[model samples]
Target: MTNEIYMTSKAWPFDQARAILRRLDIEKKRGIDRGDKPVVFETGYGPSGLPHIGTFGEVVRTTMVRNAFIALTEGKIATRLICVSDDMDGMRKVPGTVPNPDELEAYMQKPLTDVPDPFGTHDSFGNHMNARLRAFLDSFGFDYEFMSATELYRSGAYDEYLLRALNKFDDIMKVMLPTLGAERQATYSPFLPISPSTGRVLYVPMKAVNPEDGTITFDDEDGTEVTMSVTGGNVKFQWKPDFGMRWAALGVDFEMFGKDHQDNAPLYSRICKILGGNPPVQFVYELFLDEKGEKISKTKGNGISVEDWLKYAPPESLSLFNFAKPRAAKKLYFDVIPKTVDEYYQHLDGWSRQDEKQRANNPVWHIHNGTPPDENPPLTFALLLNLVSAANASDTETLWGFIKKYAPDATPENSPGLDRLTHYAVAYYEDFVKPNKAYRDPTDQERAALEDLVKRFRNVSAAESNDGEALQTMIFSVGKDHEFENLRDWFKAIYEVCLGQSQGPRFGSFVAIYGPEETADLIETSLAGNLS
Candidate 1:
């Protein structure tokens, strides 16, 4: 059977992550050598909001590292991409721009299960967001185990862990209480304790019933019932300690989080240590920026999603963007998307060039998990399209055939360079692939030059009428014969005269690859712009 390339690798550019992995690998081997269970990397996300581009970067990196470990072991060793959804996280505030945002704030400090999804199809808002993120990951081809907090809570798997953490909740809370905000250790909760008539806080024990209704029953110290009707389980704990207990109980080894969680990392870490479990991969990546350099947030109605970018570029291009260095504070705009994609591929191609010793230790060289491969056809899009159209023509000769029909007296030998066909193809596809604009036209100077060249070509004597070479020499002799900087640049100049654009495909290759008269007809029709 053929071995499929695992699209992941270990030698990534992020130095901190790679260093952590190396240590973890040693630890895992040492445990196994000592006849102990092996530890794996673990990651999770809260499904309270839409999975934005920032989320994509974090998860993609996680997947890349997970696959890298697997590839490192030649598929014999094992690692997992553990995806936990914090569906139990409370609704803080109604995110902005949500359809019917008024109702969300009502569910504040309540489990996500209580809120309705924006789409209103799911049982609750939490379910809707979770489902959307799950769909995005699935479409992205991620292999993972999807676990929801609601189900996990109801399963009783976290019962022991939650109780243990709750026993230590006082000490943990004491540490967090004083250090949390600017206030003292004032706010307190021992798994829903109640204030006595005398004003003393007392504990109120709760239990998750097997056949009991899935809701937390709150009561006063005097035994008067307050309320009931929680989902997931009959028992529950506060947020901070609960998350710590959940990680320990879930056997998560590593997980990266968003920058928003940076402040909470210490609290969670303390909880994990207190509960006798290692914190999972606790890296915090930066956020994504909009065109104006502002952080994108659904509440602000300023976020651009992955689905939006995917409409203009292919998946590979998206992957390329993900693999690029994660900037802590750089803004991403739609205008930069196309150029970045081309530069990414071009860099990959350069890395794969035949110089083995040039960049032997380069991180990007190993980013692809396998030897970097070339993407073929190396032809620009306009040229390719022109080629396709010309290829169907009756006669195939010099690109001059098409040029001659477009500018009957012009010499085709004055064509622009061919080096930029690939670059133009990339830019055009990345930016102009959707809702294509009109053809790039030529400038007045370029048009005058073409007119002069065409007139000279027609006046060529019979002795110089052998082929395009003779025509080329005649045109060259009549003018100063200024050299074009490059093919695309020159074409841009020619196009300004012919079509009015700064860049375009190689006319010669287009007509040659395509055909002569067909290309000529296209030019005559497309470029007949007031050329009296």
Candidate 2:
């Protein structure tokens, strides 16, 4: 209810915010004067390829924590989310998913910002991907300041940090060398100088490090000796070193990354402290998996995109997916869409009924920044999909016709949320549910139960037919009377014969919405093999 109460909330975002507050308290006690600075939450992006769902998840989750922190502080401390794109990093390999892959091969070792744009739209490959990243985040209306690694380096924004890194080169090397293979250890350096002649990032071992002059001497690809300043875009830190350098340079207060970065987290923190800066609070979440349970990869493009999710469901559904179980790995696929959509509405419907403490733990509060919209769709997504299958509805108008008949008071104007769901339902049913629907003839006992159900429906009064709970009880009684070994088998038979699918919504709810006599007619048709 109150900000003070919410400060002790058990919600994951609130928990993360509390960790940050504790970190600040510790720093203040240590005479670090961090109270005046706005807490900075950073999410890194490598602009070598198009942004993926992982990128969206990180930014959104960080935003949730940032909002929670603001609420906990009650506007006393400011917060900022900086989305930094590492466009200056070298492109190791061309992504297979992008257009014109062959054209990008020549620029393999060059910084992504310097490589040619395969799409032919932006000045360079990294610029094209970064624009897409910005557009993606902007579409969600996220509050973040975009920073380019190329711009930050070239404009001397990282000059001070680069000089610091130069001075701590040996210390940084001590932290990195053990993790590398024998051959990689021989060539690895904290600084990767951009070659003047070839304009490529060289991964050569430093011949000499001159901390006093803030420069490094290394052999070029041609075996020619060269010297370059670490500052002013002359050099960029390798990814591992860059992670800590960014924390030190920006004074990042919080960051959340996937579990893939868990092993190197200590390295990042060590390097941050080595460079005379405190490491930020870290939140490590499990990685998202594709439908086949493989880790989702931007380069491989094995998982659904944000646009793909929005195509079948609303943005709120996607947010709910990200909000739930950040610490557990989840299968991000099309099959999970309808379930997530229904879950989102379920949360929305229950938000008003929840007590203050319960509301604090609810995902919808974090999803909508503690102000969830008042939307209570009367039907679940599963029900809508079944309605589409049974009525063979191809458009929202057709689906809305049934919705109006089922709930006389509900209209497209009064129930805009349901109206939107109808559109998504039609598209989802057509794309996913329709093509896969399978109809099976009922067994002898199942046919007898169906015939008995038809008879019972004909005898039901019109008023009773509209009562979903009453109808559900009647269906359960029918299943019991038929002596079906498992009630699930009876429901499965109904789904296969009547709905032409292996799974369906509550049959009683379906009868109440579709009309009892109409459902009887459907059963009779299935008995006569018309549905099959």
Candidate 3:
């Protein structure tokens, strides 16, 4: 029930937070003075394309761990989350999802911060995407400081680290060269100098390195040899070197990345140490897959974005999706929305009944940073979607008409959460469920059972019809009397005949909410082969 119990929680966030504490202990034992500086948490972003769902996931997951660390320390330790955008990285290729692909082709190999903004919004493509990233994170009310790699490099923030990297260039190369193929290793250099001739980031090998002068010499695009300072934005490290340099320069205490970076993690840590700074505690989460089980890519735009998820579901549901089984690859698509929405509310509904230890492990507690909302929806999302299908509702008002009748006390004003769900249900039903509906004629046995149910409904009293449990009992008896082998098949028949779906909400509750007489009429319509 206390913070002490939560500190020992088996939740993944707490596990990661504990790793940070262990790292701090090790550092203190080594006589490393961290002083009163806060433990820094960093999440990186590549601003070559629009921010995607994967970007959102990293921030959300990191925030969860940060909150866990705060709870474990009981506010004794200060913390900061830095969201740094790698805008200075070269535009290797034009993203398929962005506008004006042809225009971007001219800017290939240029730093993303130097490319023109295709949307005509910000000064550069990188700035536009950075703005979008900040806006997206701001909408979630995340507490973070946004840093641009270009700004950091140009403003002398990275000068010291850049010069240190120059001094240890050969050692850094020794860490990286083994990872590259023969052809790549032949041309590889830790530093990528920005060419003065073409203003492009050249991938050419360094001709000479002067640690004293803190500069590098490389040939320009026109085959003219040039020497430039590695400091003050004149040069940027290749990605692997940049990753470790960022940890050292920023004094990052904790950070997380995708599984794709797992193999390179050791190299990063080594480079960080080589640059005279300790590597941060790192957490490697699994990558997200698209609907087809292909890895999601920012350039290819193969997966959904945060805005896409928000269109059919609330933000809390998306947060729940990001929170669940983070180390396992999840299929991010529209089909998962309804299930995640229901699961989010299910967790919320159970949060109050859970003990402190149980609550600490609940996803909603982490989603809300331990202060989850007290609101509970009257119906599950699955039930609402089923209601939409049965009622053929196209709008929120129509859905609410039946909802108000079922629960007289609930209104759009008092049940804001439920009201929002109604809107999402209607939208999701219209976009996904309706077009794919397949209504089939019942078999002879199913028809007989349906007729028997309609006959029983005719004799039902108003009080029994209003009570979901009572109606459920009656429905169960009908299924048993009709010799249905599996009760699930009987429910399936009801869903297919009346709702035009293979699965749906509880039939008894549907009957109670929609009225017994109305359900009987629906079955009769289905029997007449007209419901679909």
For each candidate in turn, the TM-score is 0.65, 0.97, 0.97
- Which regions in candidate 3 have their CA more than 4 angstroms from the true location? 96-101, 298-301
Error of 3 at 58 (Å): 0.7
lDDT of 2 by residue, 65-132 (tens): 99999888887898999999999998998888788899878898899999988889999989999999
Each prediction's whole-model lDDT (CA)? 0.54, 0.90, 0.90
Who is ahead in TM-score, 1 or 3?
3
Instruction: Tell me the tens digit of each residue's lDDT in model 1 across 1-532.
Output: 1112322222353343444455566756756341344445556677767787766777777776665555444555456666777776666677776897876665665667657676778998878888888898889887777787767877877666655654565567665666556442343443533222322223454432221333334455577754443322544556666666666787666667667778888778778778777666666667778788888776676755687666544455566666665536556666555555555556565775545433333334434544554543233335433432323222224333444443454332333322233334333343443234245455554445555555554454545443434544443443345443343444455444443334444454443333333334444544566321
RMSD of each: 9.4, 1.6, 1.7
Candidate 1 scores a C-alpha RMSD against the true structure in Å of 9.4
Q: Where does candidate 1 stray beyond 4 Å?
A: 1-10, 13-21, 25-39, 94-108, 116-121, 182-185, 188-244, 301-303, 344-375, 380-532
**Root-mean-square deviation of Cα positions for candidate 2 versus the true structure, in angstroms:** 1.6
Model 3: colliding residue pairs: none
